[model samples]
Target: MDNQVRVAVADDHPVIRMGIEATLDDISFIDRIGSVADSTQLVALLDTQPCDVLVTDYAMPGGQYGDGMELIAFVRHRYPDLRIVVLTSMEKLALIRGLMTHGINAVLSKADDMSHLRAAIQATRTGRRYYSPRIANLLKALPATGSARLSQRESEVIALYVGGDSINTIAEKLQRSKQTISTQKVTAMRKLGIETDADLFKYAIELGLTRKKPLSD
Candidate 1:
């Protein structure tokens, strides 16, 4: 049809991808262009396939294009006209605000009903932002005061630190001084209101900042 909205989906999990694709397929005005399992595939598909809307998972790591806020920023810049809807299970206000900052058109919680996907896609198509019920409520209920934006370096430092990397090792890996790494960690923790390493690890795990298992103390 002339007015059909071409949509592509990207999610690392097969089940979630399948469910989203199925939901997109069922939408009357949506044309399911492609569905990919990672950021790399999504970028490649976007390069070749003309799409109007992109529905992507926020935590698809291990892709050369990266994921989370990084991937969203890249896609928003690369395809300025394409509307984006982010699907995530994260409940962190900081992460949600970060996605919005990067210009995603909608934020939909994975826990929301699959039917909400259609609404999100439609809203974005019309140049409006959409948040699923749970996510909207979260935004309303949560205080926005401590949602300090994490710099790219600080985000990287937190991910590495929470993934069980020592300050010394992270410094060596990132080619920075150990003191600098320690400072970054401390600053990131303070911004995040994380009081201890255990809480930092929990925060990382909850936000899907890193895939590595938490280290035992």
Candidate 2:
């Protein structure tokens, strides 16, 4: 396929990688070059087999290189020419905004259908930005937090805490220190004017921070 849009995908879940491959296969202009499980492998693949577009999960575990913002930063720094389309389960407005600053061409939530992914890829190929409808709505609905906006990490910590995960659990899940998680929790609470756990949970629910939909949906 001459002038085909070469694509590489990185996702820890085999089912997700297969699904993305299958989705891209339906597009005649897209060529599936490589599919890997972690950010380290994705970087290695990109070094050897460069692609025009990279579709990756934001929170892929089991890699020497960290996932989420760190992985996105690494890709943006090392592969500046490679267009990135993030297909993630994370719908946090702060996180999406952070990814946008890191040169991500598109952001699509896993809750959305494959049509959004297709649109993102096509738009990215033309040097345009695309956000899934769900993500777009979430971004639009982000409420201001006090005098300063919440950072992505702060929002993540708050979301996990509000979802009933303890500070220790959130620390472990995010690969951060307990103190760091606690500090973020405190900072987030202060910013959102949440004085108690009940208030925080209610606010998180109101903002749709909890992951209600199954990943397979």
Candidate 3:
């Protein structure tokens, strides 16, 4: 049927991928085209397996395409027409907002009922954005000093730092001056009210911003 939604699922957890695939299998209007366990397999799957919507985990490490915002950015750039639904356990509104900024179609909490996955797929299928109830509430309660207050460059700097890159390395990789990277890091911390490097690392981990495992090409 032309209206049937072809869906692909990607997650690092075997059980999560299985459960999501099982759920998709029972949906009348959806076709579970394929499922994979990492970003590498996902990239290969997408390269050949056409799908209408992709339901992927937010923190899937161990793929050549590093996870988090980088993986999302890669997929969005490589497959501009593919609709993406980020199924993550991440609760920080700022992190979620970062995903949204990269043009994802939906963000659903893993805590939400599996049924919400269907709703997310439906919403994305029609080109509308969807957020799970829990995520929506978090957005409603967004604090003024939240990660959303940080500039895009600040967010990038923080993610790279928490991922284990030094200031000089980040500056080199980002093609910015060391002073600019340092300022951005300090400004990001100030915006988030983090007074120390230790606090910043802890906050990044809490927000699921730790550096992902290195991508192996």
Best-fitting candidate, scored by TM-score: 3
lDDT of 2 by residue, 1-217 (tens): 3879999999999988888889999988888899999987988899999699999998897887778877877888888889999988867655665576577769999999877777898899898989988888876664466336679999788777766688998999999999999998888776655667766664454345654442431
Backbone Cα, N, C clashes tallied per candidate: 0, 0, 0
Residue 23 in model 2: shift from native, Å?
Answer: 0.3
Q: State which candidate, 1 or 3, has the greater TM-score.
A: 3
lDDT of 3 by residue, 58-174 (tens): 989899988888788898889988899999997865566567667776998999887888899988878898999998887766446553567889989999999888899999999
Please, what are the lDDT tens digits per residue for candidate 1 over residues 144-195? Answer: 5345677899889987877778899899999999999999888877666566
lDDT of each: 0.83, 0.80, 0.83
Q: Model 3, residue 182: displacement in angstroms?
A: 13
Clashing pairs in 2: none
Global CA lDDT computed for model 2: 0.80
Least accurate stretch of 10 residues (summed lDDT) in model 1?
205-214
Task: Give each model a TM-score.
Answer: 0.68, 0.66, 0.70
Candidate 2, superposed: residue stretches over 4 Å from native: 143-217
**Residue 143 CA error for candidate 2 (Å)?**
5.2
